[model samples]
Target chain A: MATLDINRVRKSYGSMEVLKEVNISIEDGEFLVLLGPSGCGKSTLLNIIAGLEDITGGDVLIGNRVVNDLPPKDRDIAMVFQSYALYPTMTVRQNIEFGMKIRGISAEERAKATKAAAEMLQMTGLLDRKPSQLSGGQRQRVAMGRAIVRHPELFLFDEPLSNLDAKLRVDMRTEIKRLHQRLGATIVYVTHDQIEAMTLATKVAVMKDGIVQHFGTPQEVYDRPANTYVARFVGSPAMNILRGRLVASDGPVTVAFETSDGEALVSGVPLSPESAARFRDREVLVGIRPEHFTMDTAGAVPLTVDMVEPTGPDTLVVFSAGGADVVARLDPLAISVGTKARFGVKAEKIVLFDPETETRLD
Target chain B: MATKSLARQRAMGQTFIYGVLALLALYYLTPLWVMITTSLKPLDEIYGGSFIGLPQTVTFEAWSKAWSGACIGTECTGLKPYFINSILMVVPAVLLSTGLGALNGYVLTKWRFRGANLVFGMMLFGCFLPYQAVILPMAQVLGKLGLSGTIPGLILVHTLYGICFTSLFFRNYFITIPDELTKAAQIDGAGFFRIFFSIMLPAALPIIVVSCIWQFTQVWNDFLFGVSFTSGSDSPITVALNNIVNVTTGRKQYNVDMASAMIAAIPTLLVYVTAGRYFVRGLTAGAVKG
Candidate 1:
């Protein structure tokens, strides 16, 4: 196992900058996931670490040695690609043994490793089959088997489960987690799926527009996003943002906004005295998660449901609040469309942000 | 019922399609059948018989004369030396050009560098130019290097011409391979050469067979380059066949000429029969959606 340190890595193609001064450090045996939307440079960062792409300016350290100038083979990293890249001409056994054979491992040792990998992946019967003859899920297992047989210092996975069906993706995700635990290898995984990032990563780096917006544990990033972009990008059914203004300044500030019916006050948000003095009666954005809203009879805000979708376990209610669309995850039997529903926002779950800068205020 | 008429109409349409296909097949095979029939007839029968009639007597005399006894100039060495020379040129030319073309394709598709597409475009343009336009300059260069009129000169010409098409064939096939495969190999600690040989080359068997067949036929049947480059008995069999049939003021040995033409075409016919399925598969594999 090895610790990977990415120090201020930047990438550009001619004049268009793709990655800007990105920095990430992973400890030994840590599962680090770089998650973002397409064209967000998450894959670029992973490629840089693997030495497949050269960084415009920065250094990558693998186990105390700078690997910025080293080739991918010399970096001692194994990668599983989204396409499963098995040698089509070779049988499953030969595909797994190729890396060992190239590295000049003895024939006996190559055979042993191939057998053990096949057994571990439960692919003993598939040893003689070619990749074209294998089903997609079986080919994926063979791709994983090929990587693990090498037993390299670090493992790289580039959306390796993106090609599988939903059920198979879930199964392979669990298999990958178990393999990581058993091997205790450092892994840098890239995926655009937020659920995969949350479930598989020890640390998640959420990115946007070629910059790291926030890097933390999944819970930390979900609960305490650094900015509005991070807040909006990390969650499904994304966080709701409300336009409002601060109406009072004190130890416990009150932010008030005018509903169609009347004015409503949201309390218990602690603000710095200096920020409070500047935004005494100024407008700011308030962010709220879907699950943070509760069904209370004495709720401060009354919203008319525009749509209701029941997803078996939970009901998603889409309603208009503060003249903006707000989604709430409620009990399946809670409400229906065109009904007047009252929801109370918790003090701790409410987030305050500057409307212009989009940074968190409190 | 009207449904019975609709079924009969569909059956009629299907038969029309098969009829058209059979007509096209006959159109393609007619000349080859005529040549075979002409070669089997005796010399007097060839001169006096109807072009499409069955021969009165089937004889091996024409075949024997074409193989060893027919006169080309004062020498009666027939077409043996020309056949030997053609084989010498075609085998090495096909092997070298296809091997290099495949390597070039592997590099261009997987190991992309700056100006890679420009180089590929240049190669494509090379295939478009008429061979006659470049033959003189090529022959001059070969003569200066002491390669003109030799088997090596013909081999060099064949390799050059074959590369443009062979590389094109391999490149188009390789482009269908997903980039994720190469990226995955890179992450598995494979260098450029390792990834190419171990991964890309093995998956390219169908296209390689296609390239070999293409280059073999092209070099084997080439008349212009062979005639322009070498003279005397050192020329390929096509040149000898042309000299035999086109001789003015001499009695045309129609039987011997037809027999020699058939002999000259055998290598390509054998190639087509052996790797025909792979050739069609390779050509159409590009159209198969990944």
Candidate 2:
């Protein structure tokens, strides 16, 4: 296992910069996921780590060695691609043994590695089949086998599960998690799918416009996102950002805002003494996750429900709050269309951000 | 009664499709039938019988004569030498052209330099040029190089023409392969040559078969360059066949002429028969990838 340090790495083609001065450092044996939308430079960063692509202006260190100029092979890394990228002409055994053969390992060692990988993936029966003859999931497993047989210091996965069906993607996601645990290898995975990052990453870096927005544990990212982009990008149905003002009183901080019927107030919302002193009478954005809202008779404010989407275990209540579309995850049995419901959130669950900068405050 | 009528209508549709196909097949085979029967018949009977009529008394005289002692301008040597010459020219020409083309295609598609597409466009323009237009300039160049009227000269002409076609074939074929495969191979310690030989070459069998078949047919059937560039024993089989047929001798030996034509066509027929499956795959490989 090895640690990966990306120090102010920048990439550009001509005058267009694809990666800004970005920095990320992961310890040994951590599954670091770079998650973002398309054109956000996540895959580019991953390629720079693997040494498949050259960086414009920064240093990348693998296990304390600056691999700024090393070729991908000399960098001692293996990548599983989004397309599986298996050699179509080779049988699974040959595919797994291809790298080892290039390294001139013994035939006996290659056979042993192939057999162990096949058994580990539960594809021992498929050792003789070509990649085209296998299913998508099986082909992905062979790609993994090819990577694992090298026993490289780092395993890079660039959206390896993107081509799979939804059910197989979930299964392979769990298998990859298990593989990470069993091997304890350092991994840097790039994906546009936020759920994959949330489920697989020990440390998640949310990137946007070539910069790292936030880098922290998954729970910390979800609960206390560093900015509004992370809050909206990392969740299903997304977090609601409501434009309102926090009124400071000596008793307790209260959020005063417009309701569907008329102006209403929600008092007793807690705040850090630092934030309370700073934003006493200014407008701020409050971000509330869908799951944080609950059904209450006398709650923060009353809003008219526009739609209720039933998703089996729970239902999504869609309503308007402070001129933004706010969604609440209410009990399935309690939600109905065209209903007047009062929703509430705990003071600690409410995250405050500056309306101008959109960064979380206190 | 309605169900029976529907079944009858389906049966009628099937019969209609099969009938048209059979008619087309028969129409295609008429020339082949005439050629085969005419080649097997003796000269006396060939004159005695109708051109469309099958031979009543078959003889192997024409075949043996075409193989051994048929005269092309009083040489009287059969097509065996010319056939050998064609093979020798085509084998090296096809191998060299295809090797260069595969390397060119690999570089153009995978390891591209600056303005690669512009370079490819210029190379592809060679495939569209009329060989008739280049025959004069080619003759001048060949004369200057001191290779005029030689088999090696013909081989050089054929290899230069074949490169554009074969390069186009391999380029379109290699374009269908994902770049990720090359990247993954790079990570696996495979250098440029290693990755090409181990990964790219093995996956390229279908396209290679296609390129070889195309090159064989193109080089083997080229009469314009063969007749324009070489004469006498230096000529390819197509030129030899042309000479044997149009000799304007005492009496036109139609049987010897037909037999030599059949022999000239046999190699291409055999090539298609052997690698026909891959030929179809190569033609349509890039248009629809699976």
Candidate 3:
């Protein structure tokens, strides 16, 4: 059975709509991430699933039961909030045992669960200390322990790592992934970090302006983006988009555009005949991932490099092409600033979108 | 060497500032010192000379009279019943008002509802109006309910007036706590009351101490409401102190009046001495952004 299902959930505050027709289903043990920028309602969607937020127009089902009217306590779900939210007055042990205590569990059972959870999170020695006395990362682990002791049907994380420092955030990211693997628990996580979505999510739902742009496996969303927005939003250093026109309409289609220095052609997957017929000699947006560009003797476009930024592993080169600014990631040693270069676009990696609609044209 | 002289100049400037602060502290404490000296002086010495000088001979007569023998109208009630009544009224008033106010603050900050801001704005405006303007109406309502002369009635009035300020204090303090804390509690299966009592309330200790001390002093030293709502021997110490000081027919016993006023202020003064650090910390902590 699917562990959790959110069907056509919509949320609005008065006339201001925050989430619209959002839908997702998590298989029994999958880690699904709702990935979006701030104010895109990813947290709102997670709250809806946790029953902390009331859905305005649809139902949420957990383990085959619709939970639209249920309160958070009855939802059988545990959540870890961005702030850690450890009970400030309680000791770490009490914080972990609070849920079981409220549920009227036996003292022995509560002790067992608290001990096990503390041991699992490596917080046993700190169990008697108040949250104020613990470090930020330690408090975060207690928060996780608090949720783990419940062993709820589903786990919800609402940007739980956003508050940590950079190094701690990376460490917690790996810790959470390990926890997921160990528990095999159903989790619905929300984050604005695309890197986190890429690294941790089994499936990623990219949201924009309160609508899900695309929902698929991370590789699918990255490799086969459904629209121009998804293509630009899912990757770091962003995909380079160039304005072009379809020059030929045949079994094998081609697009042509003019840079400041020269004109170039890139051939790729043919559009549908109808779409190709309509776009003949019409404007289209061609998107190419930065990593797909390569320096070759027989290159498709000639350009002057404006700048080259070399990090340890890769070089990011900024250059002008097709009357647009484009960035390409190349081998760190191969590129230099203020150099004239010719780079080829991998034709199979090129994506085309309708200029007006911005939807993929493949 | 020039830098060392500049540092020396800064140190001298700081010393000058501390000297001025010490003088200001003495100036503020002058009246209390004078009252204590006068309270211990014999009436003859008090009437004979220097108002700010040490007493020629210390005596406990004034304290004794202020505690047990002083007359309030026809009764020789001194300040005992009034002091007890003030304690009774202020204790429950502070406890209830601060407790309920914290709850109100927790709800408004965490579980915001439609028109919540409007409700808060109205309550804030209510705090600014002079308390006298509402006393007559409050008195009439209480009189109709047969609570005009009761301690509970005074408590209810004090708590009602205190809620606006106390809730404002706590709500503003709670807004500084990250909403993520409450959200985390909610996800841990904590209901509204649970999250409030377990998570928010515990984090709110400093503010609660502050609100309690503030409300206690306000209600304890209150004269207007105590005089208006309460009558007979059920009056608070402030009302008794006022009557003793302001009644014109009796010989003006300034010594006794000062002692009684000081006595009436002891509770709040003791609270300040004990938890003054928490008071400043709580107020500033609430004002901090996140």
Best by DockQ: 2
Top of the candidates by TM-score: 1
DockQ of 3: 0.65
Better of 2 and 3 by lDDT: 2
Model 2 residue runs over 4 Å out of place are A249-252, A267-278, A331-333, B1-24
lDDT per residue as tens, model 1, A54-167: 889988898879999998888988888888888878899888887788788899998899999988999999999999899889999999899899888889898889999999
- The DockQ score of candidate 2 comes to 0.82
Q: Provide the global lDDT of candidate 3 against the true structure.
A: 0.86
Ranking by DockQ: 2, 1, 3
lDDT of 2 by residue, B183-220 (tens): 99999899999888888888888889998999999999
Fnat values, candidates in order: 0.79, 0.98, 0.76
Each candidate: what lDDT? 0.86, 0.89, 0.86
Tens digit of lDDT per residue, candidate 3, span A331-362?
A: 87665667776888787777889888898886
Which candidate would rank higher by DockQ, 1 or 3?
1
- Ordered list by TM-score, greatest first: 1, 2, 3
> Model 1 Cα displacement at A285 (Å)?
1.1
TM-scores of all models? 0.95, 0.94, 0.93
